[model samples]
Target: MQIVHSPLHLRHDGGMELHRGALVPCYEMPARAEYIREALVEAGHALVVPRDFDPEALLAVHDADFVAFLRTAHARWREDGRDGFMLPSGFPARGLRRDRVPSGISGAMGYYAFDAGTPIVEGTWDAAFAAAQCAMTAAALVAEGERSAYALCRPPGHHAGRSVYGGYCFLNNAALAAQQLRERGFGKVALFDVDYHHGNGTQDIFWERDDVLFVSIHGTPETEYPYFLGYADERGAGAGEGFTLNLPLPRGTGWDTYDAALDTALQRIADFGADALVVSLGVDIYEGDPISAFKLGAERFPQLGARLASLGLPTVLVQEGGYAVREIGTNVAGVLGAFGACR
Candidate 1:
């Protein structure tokens, strides 16, 4: 398997986030992707040549203003005489009478972010952009007929939405790859987000589109970090009718429950007959992950890869959340190794 990565990802360190009612060290640090890269290298996976994933490709899915805001938010924040990482504070949340966006940097942060958990550091835009390059590079490989490639992306992207950013993700890497395939002439693509938390961002991006199908299996939103969306009934809209599928499960789910959910999602992709597949690979489903509530153990990951391989579609694996730093590499490597065997 080819692994796509870039050193620029390390630039996005030293950010802070609001956690448990107080600002804390950000868990979605640069090391998350680096560790995966190191493990892949150690496991003997070939690191592929990274493509020049330009900004124009990003324009396909994200709003221009939102992209411009991210590129300039740090400097704009500095222009206001504050130099800390940007994190949102206020919201026009439930029962609020207005939907208009607030003005100023802080207000803008709140408007652009879905939560305070993801903080934007001075180097966030550069690193996140590189992370997209990582994903797009791997994706292009698969598009060119490679069976599988791994995008070792940091600032994992399952949480970012079309016009908003959160959960340590600034750009939706998996979604970006899916759209890239569509632009490159693939009639259909499927994004299977098997993260511990629901891929609210990916779902939102393609929620009303039919060209790319979005399927997610995650801890139910009723009690997850996202806290909304990801219901069983969000089966797409308009031309996208029946293209989106959400398999939200209760907490304490283990390998057996997750496997069943994956089975159903795979069957959906089969019915859709997608030309390519993007897996939002998040090992945070590991039993020991700090923030998640699943009981899947390390040894079960190889089976996860095997199951994904069963689909027999060209696949791009984009690294996502996996906070149990110690066991993370093992779990990720296990999946990749299993997939490698299938090929």
Candidate 2:
């Protein structure tokens, strides 16, 4: 498999995040992608630099105003005389008026952000844009007839929404890839998110469309982060009814339990008869992860990849969340290598 990545991701380096009621080092650091890229290279996979893509690709899955905000947020924060990275102090929740975008950078941060964990630094926009480009380039390869490709995106997406950015994600890279496949004439595309956290942002982006089917298997919302959506009852609305499938597992879930959920998700995609597949490949489910709570061992990732390969569809694997910095590369490369062997 060809792995698409960019050194530009190094630009969005270090920052602090609000976690567990205290300021902590951001788990979503630049090392995540670097490690994965190095592993793919060591495994003899060709690393391809992402091609530049137009902003319209982003607009297909994200709001235009939100994109503009991401592009200028850091500059605005700098102009406002802020010294450190920008994090939202408050959110426009409950009774607050969210109909209007706030004028101040602080209020705007809250307006566009769903949580305080994602900080805005000077290189955020460029890094995020390049990540999206990596995803798009991988999707283009699959669309043009490659069997499968990997997009090693950093500042991982899947938690971001159309107008809101949070959970260490600024742009929804997986959603952009699925949309690109659709535009490239794939009659139907299936996006399967195997992240430990539910891909709430991806679900939100494709919630109203039937052409793209979204399926996710994650920790139950009652016990996990991003505790708003991801319930089994959140079926798509309107024309998208029954197009979404959420398999919420509990904490301490092991390989046996996860494999059952994966079977169900894979069956759903097979029934959908999708022409292309987008896997939001997240390795955070590993037992060693810091913030996540699933119990899949490093050895199980190859089985996960082989199962996905059983579908026999053109696939684009877009990198998502995984905080076990040291083992992340080996875990991810295991999946990709297994998938390549099966294919």
Candidate 3:
């Protein structure tokens, strides 16, 4: 499989993260992508820098004002002489006046963000834009007849929604890829998220659309981060009423249980007869991950890849969350390598 990546991803380096009521070193560091790239290289896969995609590609999946905010937030934050990273400290809650957006940078941050875990550094927009470009480029590869391609996106997306950014994600890369596939003439696409956390942003983007089917196998939001969406009953609404599926697995889930969930998702995709597949591949289900709880090991990742390959659809794998630095590369490599082998 060809790998699309960019050195520009290193720019989104957040220094700290709030975890369990304490500030700690950010787990979503640039090294995560580095390790994955190194592993892909060691496994002898070719890596290519992503090409520039039009900014409109972003607006295809996100709100225009939100995109404008991401592009200009750092400059606004610096103009106010704010020190350190830009983290939101306030938010609009239930029953609050949500009609108007505030003029100040702080208020805008709070207005546009859902959590403080994702700190915005000066280079965040540049890096996130590049990451989205990587995803689009990888998707274009599959659209042009490649069997599969991988987009090694950093500051992983899957949490950031149409108008919100959090969980270390600013741009919804997977959603962007699916939209790109639609623009490339695919009548229908299937987006399967295998992240440990629910792909709330992804679900939100395609929640009411029928063109792309969104399915996620994730930790139940009841006991996981982003504890709002991702329930079994969150079937799509409107034209998408039956296009969305959420298979919420319990904590400490291993290969057997995860395999079942994958099978169910695959069967749905088969029924849908999608033109292409986009896998939000996150390895955080690894037993050793610092912020997630699951029991998947490296040995089982290849099997997961093989299962996806069995579908025989053109595929694009967008990197998501996987925080175990030590084993992250091996785990990611196991999946991609096996996918290539099986294909």
Clashes of each: 0, 0, 1
The window of 10 residues in a row where model 1 has the poorest summed lDDT is: 94-103
Residue-by-residue lDDT tens digits, candidate 1, 47-144 = 86568867978888888878988898989899989987777778768887346666588888888887888878788898899889888888888888
Predictions in order: lDDT: 0.86, 0.93, 0.92
Q: Which pairs clash in the backbone of model 3?
A: 236-241
Which predicted model would earn the best lDDT?
2
* Segments in model 1 whose C-alpha atoms lie over 4 Å from true places: 95-100
lDDT (tens digit, per residue) of candidate 3 on 262-313 = 8999999999999999999999989899899889877888998899899899
Question: All candidates' TM-scores?
Answer: 0.96, 0.99, 0.99
Worst 10 contiguous positions by lDDT, candidate 3: 16-25
Ranking by lDDT: 2, 3, 1
Ranking by TM-score: 2, 3, 1
Which consecutive 10 residues in model 2 have the weakest lDDT in total? Answer: 13-22
Query: RMSD, model 3, all Cα superposed?
Result: 0.8
Deviation in angstroms for 208 in model 3?
0.7
Clash-forming residue pairs, model 1 = none
Give the C-alpha lDDT of model 3.
Answer: 0.92
